[model samples]
Target: MTDTGWTTERMPDMTEKTVVVTGANSGLGYEVTRALARKGATVVMACRRTNHAKTVKGRILTEVPDATLDVRELDLADRESIRSFAENFEADYDNLHVLCNNAGVMAIPRRETEDGYEMQFGVNHLGHFALTGLLFDRLLETPGETRVVTQSSGVHERGDINFEDLHGEQEYDKWDAYAQSKLANVLFAYELDRRLDEAGIDNVLSLACHPGYASTNLQRRGPEQEGSRIRLWMMRLANAVFAQSAERGALPMLYAATGEDVMGGEYVGPGGLMNMRGLPEIQPSSDRSYDEQMADRLWEISSDLTGVTYDFAQAKAADDD
Candidate 1:
């Protein structure tokens, strides 16, 4: 149990491993990819913009000359893009060691995805949900233990899932939708762990993590693009004053993804005041996030909405073979 005070320096050697990180072009995803690549993992930078992903890959290679990276186009807002990414990955790679669902949109003007779902819930939760389901088989087929690390948020505590208005068709609040999506991230992670256990599959671990008030563009870009100038400035000021570096914020995710002491269903965050800033540690999420019934319901809804379902039996069979 890595209860508290864990750093990325303790990450196990990742030589010969393969990792896919969503939103690898910037922020926490960039840091995670860089760290893993430095540790000798073959990292795939999955982003919506292929050009941006290529540029980031170049930057990473400049930093770690020996780093192995593959730039792939992956627009989480589009289900077809998710399917294509997964299919291409499966065809190119024989095994997958980690799938980090790290891409997300924060508090912004209410917008719908190409698929017509609320932007936050669509890209942050449903998109990754569908992606993970599509790639579960490859993960299970890997020779050793694999992991799926989903990024949630501390604000999830204030979130409430309105199943009646899952898409915010009835009403919309930017913060509320963001919080709900982050909560869904946790719910999905824990529920996936449970389902994996019930299926008697032990090699794949599902984990969730938060950045803990990291100073990433995620905070500013949302408001910069949609909110008032005052809101943008406020976010920038808050980040400069209170937020930690993106590298620091990424510790929880790196720990959960590669820390040997970590287990499935664990929620990790910064082990500081209010889980806001510090080294990575195991943290508790909200009571609602642990509601088994709600988790199951969300899973069912997500599967139906995304047209993606987990075939654990098939994956397990492949693993056995």
Candidate 2:
């Protein structure tokens, strides 16, 4: 950890800021929403289930009675849902200060999303990719600094983008799919920063962060989906023994989103033993994640697949004017 041991307490005042957190009903997202709200930010809880998110919002309101929260339905698996959410958000809010692409699934059984893409890759990477593209205009036009923070994982070190068999139709491995998706998150974050710089746009920052080994419902989903009692027990034991609480795990993301010294393209995570649990700090990602060639290829393919190409030139032109 850094000498100062950065924590959420160090976050700047967020009064008047509007933040959107995907999957805000549970785990790290929930913790992030609560913390941002406590700091006086208006948080839009972009969740898949409106009812559950409203309940979570109530929980937050109980803790921070004056917190401002807006629960909106967002299903990352479906492109239509994403578009609708963006449209509704544009109608409801004039400015967006932060977009936290934090919701994700872990190692689960092979499945396809509404658009037929692999579920893990679709929701974790492409979904966020499309969402960011759709709402990037607001980020550019909004006054003052803005941020796009993506959540990745340490397992991303083992990921390889299989261009030939992107969906793993021939050979499927759940962990491999999850790793690929997480890696894509980091790549997208870095590539976005590069594009912003290239376009001479400095008002928006893009970053990626990971919650070391936070104990959350994500780890249990795969085992439960597989109906393996032994695996579920093992996961539970690991969480009990080694994992940190979701609140602690969320610090890295919160720091990335609100830290005064945070920079675009940095990857933040725990600074404890083996980067498993501790205070948030800037860290290096895997060598593969820094490959410009791979990132460019992924960016092109993602835009083609999602049909949501970024219009950075337009933002630059507006700034020039």
Candidate 3:
């Protein structure tokens, strides 16, 4: 369970900023897109399924009245799709204030993504990894303010990367794999923040956020080995008591995107009932998560796998001289 204390007290006015949010067809992503659009940001909703994103556009306009919503086609799980989306998006927009890596899949049964990596890890971690790398320049060109928000999960609290079996190739435990991906999310955020700071880049922040136990479709898609009524009943009962609505779940990410007092690399989450529901606040990470060696190793491994090294060394030199 989470024990962080965070709430949405300070939200910035993003009148001319352009924000791109992935997986904005439903749930927390949808809420984030609408909220940003309401605040006068030209919000681009990128989803795998254009039809679904179009539907969300209609729904959001209904609520936001004059919402500036643009739905784009993107499939994060596929490298080709990611490249296409990035190229197309770049051809249109000159500067982007926010890039929300909010798309992901939960612990599905043993399966492979379009790229052959474990589904959970591939979609949840690697997919976003590539997407962010592709859009790195766009984010850097924000001129004044640029924020990248990664939607981590509380399960990251119980995550550890298994390099020996990173892809879950030897053996697969859906929950453990999911945990690893979430943990990767945090490490990726921290690593990005460190790199940015070393590069002397200011007004651009990378943050990690979790919604705690929000009542979303994520739980229903988790590892279901057998159809056990007892487990199902227990989940329903727990969810009924602990889970918050999608709006509340979207707070930590939104806070990270717009909160005035937040520092880069800080983990943000809900601040109530073991982090199940509440406003956004600063949070602590597990001790193991602070291992610089592990983070570096993971970074090297990710770069090798995705062929998308961030090249912070060059960025630092550029920032300095």
Candidate 4:
């Protein structure tokens, strides 16, 4: 079976699936959460702000009267917070079927997270990295199917990871840093897929997706700024003309998360105009994104950086037993 395209028709039955979506209070996250809840999937809206998440949960249940949603606090920039959220989730849920690693930070002024790492890499990449590792057991315990869908972005086309300056210690370019984080997302997903395949585990799939140029609050941190007034004006025009709705922007993720025949490490995104806006389309990963040497190095570095190391090779060997 080939998942060559996107639509809700191929959506897997969600009656018994439990989905966990980070940053589900708004934009793509909110829409995905709403749709999943409407499909009768129990969704855990893991967010940094519980207050705002409360509002979003209410809004979703109001529209999806029977939606099952739960709110959990998670500040991705803080490792302690990430740990706390994971522990709580483990205790609360018996099975976690899908994990949408979608929360992200984009091009904010040079600010370090609590762990003294670049905010984008920390939150967008490391946070999800840790979360997924913590929840690996629950996902594996599921009946026959499970997935961890990581979200990347088109900006990854311009990304290159500098091992010399992983923390952006010497120089900092917000856009570059952001791209690196997105690239890391793809790398992480691909590496996990390779591991799962080597372990001969067809029950799990690790995938990546992008929202394209969606008209969402994802840019509120950048274009919505006072200093970026010109960009702000341009955003209004671009959003009106080029961007799709939050619902449409979320389709790639929805498809990746729920579609049948979803191959591990497959990249999904909008097909129109530089992949900025359009319906969900299966796409090719960047050449740079397929560098196994770099990905292996990144896997090691990420484990070192996050202090949540797991040897996929060893796991595969154990699975062979």
**Which 10-residue window in model 2 sums to the lowest lDDT?**
1-10
Name every residue pair that clashes in candidate 2: none
Model 3 lDDT per residue over 67-86, tens place: 88899988877889988999
Model 4 off-target regions past 4 Å? 1-5, 224-226, 311-321
Q: How would you encode candidate 4's per-residue C-alpha lDDT over 214-292 as one tens digit per residue?
A: 8888776765543888887887888889888989888899998998766888999988778887778789889999998
TM-scores, in order shown? Answer: 0.97, 0.99, 0.92, 0.94
lDDT of 1 by residue, 189-256 (tens): 99999999988899999999999999987988677777489988888899999999999998998998
What residue pairs are clashing in model 3?
6-279, 6-280, 6-281, 7-280
- Residue 9 in model 4: shift from native, Å? 4.8
Best by TM-score: 2
In model 4, which range of ten residues has the least summed lDDT? 1-10
- Root-mean-square deviation of each candidate, in angstroms? 1.4, 0.9, 2.5, 2.3
lDDT of 4 at 263: 86
Question: lDDT score, residue 296, model 2?
Answer: 97
Assess candidate 4 and give its TM-score to the true structure.
0.94
What does the lDDT read for residue 269 in candidate 4?
90
lDDT of each: 0.92, 0.95, 0.83, 0.87
Model 3 bad stretches (over 4 Å): 1-10, 223-234, 316-321
* Candidate closest to the true structure, highest lDDT: 2
